[model samples]
Target: MILKTIFLGLEAGGKSIVIMNGDDAERLGVLSLGRVAIRFNGEEKTAIVHKSSKLADPGTIGVCKRVWSDLGLSEGAEVVVEAASFPDSLYFIRNKLAGRKLGSDEMREIVEDTVAEKLSDVELSAFVTALHSFGLDLDEATYLSLAMIETGRTMKLDGGPIVDKHSIGGVPGDKTTLLVVPLVAAAGLLIPKSSSRAITSPAGTADRAEVLMPVTLDLDEMRGVVERTGGAVVWGGAVHLAPADDIFVKVEYPLSIDPLLLPSIMSKKRAVGADLLVVDIPTGRGAKVKTIGEADLLAKDFMEIGSRLGITVRCAVTYGEEPIGSAIGPALEAREALEALMNMGTAPDLVDKATAIAGMILEMAGRSDGKVLAEELLRSGRAVEKMREIIAAQGGDPDITPDDIVVGEERLTIESGRPGHVLWINNSSVAEVAKAAGCPKDRGAGILLHKKIGEVVGEGEPLFTIVAERTSNLRRAQERLEKARILAVGDRMEMLIHEVKERPVVKRSFNLDR
Candidate 1:
């Protein structure tokens, strides 16, 4: 049947959708959540159908933003509407739902439909949930990676060794990439780094880097920056590298599962033509991987996938018991990272972790004195210079300094009640407190630690300070802090952690940062 287009001027989060009148829908034999084939001007596209009796007239169809843009529909253009069949990928998804492993062709079709926006949110959620329920093997992971790479934009720079780094993030205040990018770039290597924004953590690498410079550079701009300065820190979502991973991320976030962790990380690396890669797994009781053994297992999987993708991969299992540095928000962490790069302050752990990872990349690329060289570059101010170059190339202020980065003005200092050595720090609690203070959004809102693990604290001395852009947010963070044991200062470790009185609803914390 032919119908007139009634523009809805709405976006369904990149999904193609159209609203049909209830009578027209009945004649077409399509349900409210069914599919429709919209054809106009010899061009056709599939859209999800939403039946409405009042919203749309009987002889007209309401076109959403995605479908409207795709078909170039005008206010009263004529279009052909017909009942559409479900995609074949749905069958494959059902097979996976039944706990059967999918083949390469099946995985490819599902991922293609995902990229093409042919699958609705419900279907996509079912696919991700099935993967989470019945974990995918390495073969399935490789297929997913290849399909994701094929569907998205890729960067191909003519270079000898294209190196990159990624952190399986869980720990808060990890500004390591801020140092690693400049440090590695200073050593003269092409590093087109694409990072993600915060999903679960207080801040992601892109969130922190955005404080220092613009991270939404397109592929051309990213390549230009890397070509000129040997490195760049851009947001992955902007580059469209492994865009299917972005759609999958949306499904995984609500479900609190990340079964595609391997493909999600490796596919982007492969898309960027990376020759060498380093994956950082922060391992500890408070981290995503709660133990060293688990970290190693994750590392093995990464290496195996890397090998299959023709990229040399190494894993760095670092200490994750606490926040990486004293800062736990975007602006504050950026300031801390800048200070470490300039050697103006003592963030030994941050410096150590950055240099160690940079060193690994260097050593993997055939440098024996990797750590030493990394340290030298940082100590000699070369890393800072290189960082400035990168900032200038990426359209940020090259003269940006630690003092120039503004943090939240409103501050609350948490004091130590008794004198002792700091025993432990809860990474999750730190993230929670930081988030309460209007974290990534506020940019300046965060926490600054006065002491770390094993540091001696005097009675009534300040333990940490929480900063916020607004008074209300500061109060909110204060409330969360009251219920959280963020830091423990004691002469000896406590044997009993917590007593369970009865059965409790366990809210499993899943770290979804990539």
Candidate 2:
């Protein structure tokens, strides 16, 4: 159909969309949502079709601004329209939905279509849902990982033994990357770490790092920064690595990033040229991989995939029953990380966890007594200097001290309901409270713990502190936790009765924790 173009001046996601006249639709035997091929100014692309007599006059097509820009046409331009041919990957997606494994080439085609915007959100969601519903087999997962790596940009580091770590994030207040990277890098290793923002928790490695230094560096800039400082922490999204995984991530974990985590990790590490990788899988109640068996299987999968992709991998299962550090937000965690590196923070868990991971990296690099070397670096202040150098390289203030970190102005202190021994701290509840208080986005938003498991507190004594940019968020978080006992203050017998929720949501036994 020949029609006049009416630019619609809007974004229709990545798909090109055009509206057809009702009369023209009837003449062409088309429906309201048919596919069409739009052509103007020597350019043609497939577009989804909509019909409206009011929006466009007869014999005139309405185009979104994206289509107009693609055609290099202004309003009232002329174009030709025809039925569009659908891509073949949709059939493979349907096959997967029917419990069929996709071949490597088929998966590659689907991922390429995703990156090229040839697939709509609905179509892409179908792919993600299929993968989620019938989780990919190891072969399929490995192929999917390779396809993702092939389609996106990759980082090239000049040095051998590019060491990296993946904190399989589940526990709240687990911000040790800030300390471990500095610790490992101080010992003459190239550790270029790329992290993501928070998903289900208050903060992620990248989010917390952003509180101190810029995490969004382009590939070239990231390379330069690492070259200068021997290590750096940045966001993986900036480098265009495994971009198809990012799309699946958007569908599965809207504000999170855990769907198809196996591929996500392997592909990202492979893209960055990491030779040795340590995967931190925190296992316990209220955390992912709650059992040693599950963690072992996951670790084996990591090793298998790493072998398939030619990378050496290790998995560290750490305690995740409670928050790792004293703080649980961007700014607060950044400060706490620096304090831990400075050997001034009282968070023994944070210090122990950081040293443990750094020690693993040191051991991977053939160092003697990895834990001791890691501690020596942290205590000797060389890690602090390395951190300063990294901060400066990433466009942040090198001399910025922990005192300079600005946390939420509005705050509330949670006190113990009754005086007794602290039995446990629910990781999920604390993470939820902090997220409600406005995290990741609000740099100053977070939570601070005063008492942990096995500690004692008096009635009305401080248990934890909630900080937020707005008083409303702080109050909301407080209400959520008012009836929730994240920090139980009673004996094991009493603890069995008290739970994380107000009322009994589950018949949970304290046997595992005990």
Candidate 3:
């Protein structure tokens, strides 16, 4: 049926969509959420259909930005609309939903369609949920990784040993990347680090780094920075490496599931031509991997996948019972990282963790006393210098200092009620509080701890401070604190953790990060 085009001037998050009146939809033999083939000027495109009685007229079809641009449709242009069948990928997705493992061809087809925007959000959500429920075997995971790598852009850098590091993030305030990149690069190795923004956490590495430098660099610009300074910290979204993962992440965010974790990390590493890689698995209570055994199993999977993708892999099972440093938001973490790199302040745990990870990358690249060398790089002010160079290369201020970084002015300090030694810190609750304070979005909003696990605390002494750009956000965080116990302090361990007077509703915290 020939219909006039009405440009909607809006996007469906990269999906092609069209709206039509109920009468027009009935005449064309299509229903809402159905598919339609639109043809204009000898070009054809398929878009998901939405039916509206009043928004669209009987003789006109409303086109979204993506479809309108693809078809070169103008306002009141003539176009042909016909009912269309869904792609075969939907069938494969159905099979997965039925607890069937897909072959390599099926996986590749699904990934290709996903990149081509042939699958709608509902279809993609089904696929992601199926993987989460049924899970993927090693072979299936490998197939997905290769398919994603093939379907996305790749980088080929000329270097002897291109090293990279990743953390299966669960701990908050992890600005280790800010230190690791400069440390390893100062030791003469190529480290092109691409990180994600906050998914289910208060802050991600990219979010924190973005407080210091521009992270949204394209692939070419990323290469230029890496080539000049031997290191770079850019956002993965702009690079288009395994672009399908970006879409998958969007689906996984609301679902709180990440079945694609293996392929997601390995695919990006393969795309960047990383020869040696270290995956940090924060293990302990309050971390993703709650036990050392679980961490070891995860490490094995990572190593196996790296072997399949021709990248060497090692895992660092680090302590994750508490936040990495005193800071737990983007700006606060960035400032802490810079201070650590400059060796100006005493963040013993943060410095130790960063140097150890950087040392692993060094040792993987054939260096002796890797930890000592990494320490020297920081102590001698070389890592900070390298970081300055990287910042300048990425179009940020080279002379940026900790004090130069501004934080939120609205703040609240919680103090200890009783004197005791710090017993434990709840990572999830900490993240929740920071998120309530408008973290990541409000770069200056965050939390700073005055004490950590095993530290001494005095009655009425400061426990932690919450900072926010707005008083409303600070109040929101304070409200979250009333319901959540972020840390514990006591003279002795309490035998009774809690009392269950009746049937209790348990809410599990789900963390999804890359």
Candidate 4:
């Protein structure tokens, strides 16, 4: 039946949902809560059906953003929705859940179905849970990666040895891509750094980069930007590479489990045509890998997967005991990244970590002294210049300065309770506080570190500052801080260390040696 599309500004997370008037549902023989095959612009998708009396007239169908987008229907545009059936691949997902080892063909079929959104959130979650329960072997992981790559778009740089970096992620405020990309680009390497939005943290590399420039670019635009400036920092999601990754990610967000890590990571890198890749594995307390042993095992898996795909992969097991830097929001992180690139940021840890990661990538690309080269590029202003060129190429102001970036107007400074040395900064607490302040989404909201572990703090000295776009958000962050032990201080905290110290140990305890 043809029905007018009415917008419903709600996130129908993991499923397309359409709302209809009770009279329409009763008259059209459509029941509320039943599946409907919605069609518009020669495209069709199954969305969960909802019925409302006051929401719409009898002839109209209410669509949330996902449905309207998936069907390509304009507001008030006519749509045809009918009863739909389950997809053929749904049985394969069930088989996986039954402890069956799926072959490459089966995996590819499932991935194809996933990318096409044939699987419901329930089906998708079932697949993720099956993998999470039974787990995927290296061979299976490789197949999944290949399948993910095949299911979406692929890009190839004009030349050889295009490099890329990825973090296992659990640490917050990780904006190294901003520094690493520019530094590597200055070294004349093609580093098309495609990052994600804030999956969990206050800010992701792409989110931070977006604060300076646009991150969403098509292949041609991204290639043009990279060709002009040795590198480009953009959102991988925007290019729609390995689309299954995001589908799983959306389900995993609520499930709180990371299934199919190998395929999910490798597929994105492979889709981007990364020949030389660096995987940053932050292993410590409150991190994805709680032990160095686990990190090593995961690192081995990454390298082996890379070998299967014919890519050179190096895994850098960095410290993830805390957030990467002092700034844990988009605009704030972008500002801090620039400051560090210019060698003017007080957050030495942020600068040092970026240099370390970039150096490793450089070393993998045949440079013996990667750190030295990275530092030189950063210090000599070449890295920043390349970054500015990239920013300009992506339609941002290349001449924009760090100070020109404005963070949230509302601010709150958290101070030490007593005179002591800094002991630790809880990664989870820091992330929570920043989230409370409205980071990633609220680009201007975040937390800034004034002191890190082992730093001396006088009574009432500021520990960190939180900035929020609105007073309510600032207050919300303050309320969250009251329960979180973000910055620990003790008369004897941890021993005082040099300002150049690069400790990645998180605030919590871990079993790394074992």
Candidate 5:
């Protein structure tokens, strides 16, 4: 069918097409080649017929044709379009991409096609935005989750009750995963965890874990490691689990949209075949869940979704007003996590959070005796031993110690200005300092807090230390600390502005009809 249209602009790569007047484009479907009739302002204009290949290349057109064919659209169907209508067309495309009652094979196709970079960033963004806006129903989320799982490599363990934990993230310095996995595994639970690298922060779980041992593991190696040592900490990026989630994350991270966050979390857990899951939801200023109420709602949602997915989900709403551990960078966090697990050093907050989380996992696995069991496993060297076994199994040095983990060459110390109690610590500011120090990149670059909130410090006492590989980074981090009002030395903490702003009302007119 012939359609009238105007060519808008070119997309990054080909995939450009003339826009028609109506939504019949979906009905006409995508054409490898089509005719366009342009009409301006209700007046018939000249036809601007062009080949679809002119918009993109032959390869892109072929892919589009294949995708359209998969959608069961017919060729030569009349399509009404306009260049300005691309945005709306995106929505239609996304809905189709989400698919209704999709099978495992179809889901696999989506993931493979997506990873091949067949979809442009804009198209990917549209699909993600549509899922976020319309919300993925349980069935759809399950399908999508399963699809993502199968698209990438799958690690199979020859056992049940494989224990694992995950944090929904969006909080910097919540390095509980690094600590919890080792702690649980040390307790003799089969815990094979896959973590992500940093997206916005300077350090992610994978980054931090890499500080101690290698995190990049193939699927076979991962399964072998888990089988041999009963646990392994590795990077998820290396092995795809819920790959679509990764694509969506590229969009969600920048926009901070998490409408389907709970599903995403549970789906990953389900995909990994974690029978028991402990989800840490940090709630406070600068965290994903900003309030206790919101955190509770999310916790409930996660538990319910997990149940539906045949997994047990337990959530903890931890304090996130500040960094959980003294370390913030990948290497620094890894060093600290190892130290804590090995019982060689102590970061009370980190230790407490880890023990609490590990305890919960142990409880779910029916080995609960609170921190007693957790501390015993850690202090008796069982956890450390397990960690060593896992590390060695994963191709890392089992004898690696905290001292073995190197730090940046350049370092700077932050001193207390006044002799008073540390009232508050701003997590976001701390993350900024760590980022400036090059935590994830430098591995050794990060901030180590010597004092925490409620701790009394003398004037000129060392408050924190910034480590970096370069002098410039040290100075940059120091400069950031100079301007950062992260710590408050007073009796009371400053309150945040949490009130919502009111919008002005607009008058409306209506008539009653008989």
Candidate 6:
């Protein structure tokens, strides 16, 4: 317990070493050299671990084996120690840490402290991997959500019926946020929307919004924008709300593990002071939730969790077997979303879905006839006006047109091979192709869908077009699209079936004793 000196080196077997005093070693239950612990003197502290090399001075104490043993290690154990405390960062680890399973409370504390800059990245990664492996149950997820909320900034708006919409994201070119926010806002509702940048898509809502005006705004600026326009689209990362979720996403992205953090996802909206919420769960062969059952379960979880968190959650299970809109990149999708708002775009599916979703938000926000209100807003140009106000508030010219937004000069058209019905357009393929085309970064890079599924196409008609700032990216996009066969056409329409075949049961058993 007394003040002690610190020494660092390696042990005989090449394990890191730390040196401490005899009294400390005895108190720590170390009987032999080569142990691990910490020593503090005044304001300085150092780690003591087993060192492979010999000590230069006899005065330097060797770490005791009993202390190492007490510190917890199995046979053939090795330990590495560092002087710095774990910084508050999410850690990506390949193996599990040696410890008892974390309880809900402990996990919440870890996540909160980590986000608050109390834990190091390595420790955070360790904790993340632990959670990922053993998995967080509903209770744990709920606690984690609360912890995330406690650690970050929360917006407290005095307005009622503030609605927000979110998509689990997998399908590309789903720029519904652009239309939905304005439509709902124009219906005399509050929707201070915040979206993320592209993680795996050619463009994210935030990325697309950036095409027209700045999406990143500070807390005060965001609130002002929302108060002035009744709605504003901005990037969530610019705010510190649910900061841990952002860190978790960075780690979760490469792992491709859907933590399915329903509470965490909803908490951000709750944190933003949203009372009404619409969640879009895109389910299809190529989407994140591949099965209808999976999407349903996720939707239920989101709704249940949202209810518990004091938010009304309405889930929309939408079609994502293909891309949602005619545009599959940042600039293209931005252009398309703007045109759809102005009722100038031809992508009826995109407009329809956006209007439907926005209508739901409107209904929840007290619009008696949500669909009609939403349509009137769009057709009468109120939604477009709201969007213009939002754009102007976010530091952009309100009068900017879709054509005024310059795209990449490099473009390539995919012509129909033969006259037939367009059978399918794979969402994953479109996402990959657009990404290859340098979408979110290039702003001008993305794909424009000219022919949608079930549409009749002539041999000379264009199926889609790829645009990019670079010719190499255009070629890459073309190559990826060609490999995936995104635009499939045939004389006959392909029908998907769910059939069950039963086999006759054979009754036979062998006697093991015999």
* Candidate numbers sorted by lDDT from highest down: 3, 1, 4, 2, 6, 5
State TM-scores per candidate: 0.98, 0.90, 0.98, 0.87, 0.76, 0.78
TM-score, model 2 to reference: 0.90
- RMSD per candidate (Å) reads 1.2, 4.1, 1.3, 5.9, 10.5, 10.9
Tell me how candidate 1 scores on lDDT: 0.93
For candidate 3, what is the TM-score? Answer: 0.98
Supply every candidate's count of residue pairs whose N, Cα or C atoms clash at under 3 angstroms. 0, 0, 0, 1, 9, 20
The lDDT leader among the candidates is 3
Pairs that clash in candidate 3 = none
Assess each prediction's global lDDT (C-alpha) against the native: 0.93, 0.83, 0.94, 0.84, 0.67, 0.72
The deviation in Å at residue 352 for candidate 6 is: 0.9
User: Where is model 3 more than 4 Å wrong at Cα?
Assistant: none
Error of 3 at 192 (Å): 0.7
List runs of model 4 lying over 4 Å from the truth: 1-84, 493-514
Q: In candidate 4, where is summed lDDT lowest over 10 consecutive residues?
A: 505-514
Please provide, for model 2 over 404-514, each residue's C-alpha lDDT reduced to its tens digit, 9 standing for 90 to 100. 998889988878888887888887778778878898788899888998888878888998888999989988888888655577787553625534656655633211100
* Tens digits of lDDT, candidate 5, 1-514: 4432222333423232333322343344533223332232343221112344344232112113322332232433323333221323333445456654444454456555565444446566666666666666666666666666666555557776887888877666677776677678776678878888887677888887776678888767788888887888888867666666676676665565654465556666766678999888888876767899999987877787777778888998888777877777877787787888778666778888888889988998887485778877878877778878877887778888888888888878878777888987877677778878886788888888888878988999998888899999888888888766656775565586235578746422110000
The digit string of per-residue lDDT tens for model 1 on 173-197 reads 9999999999999998888899999
Model 5 ranges off by over 4 Å: 1-118, 134-140, 494-514
**How many angstroms is residue 261 displaced in model 1 relative to the true structure, after the best TM-score fit?**
0.3
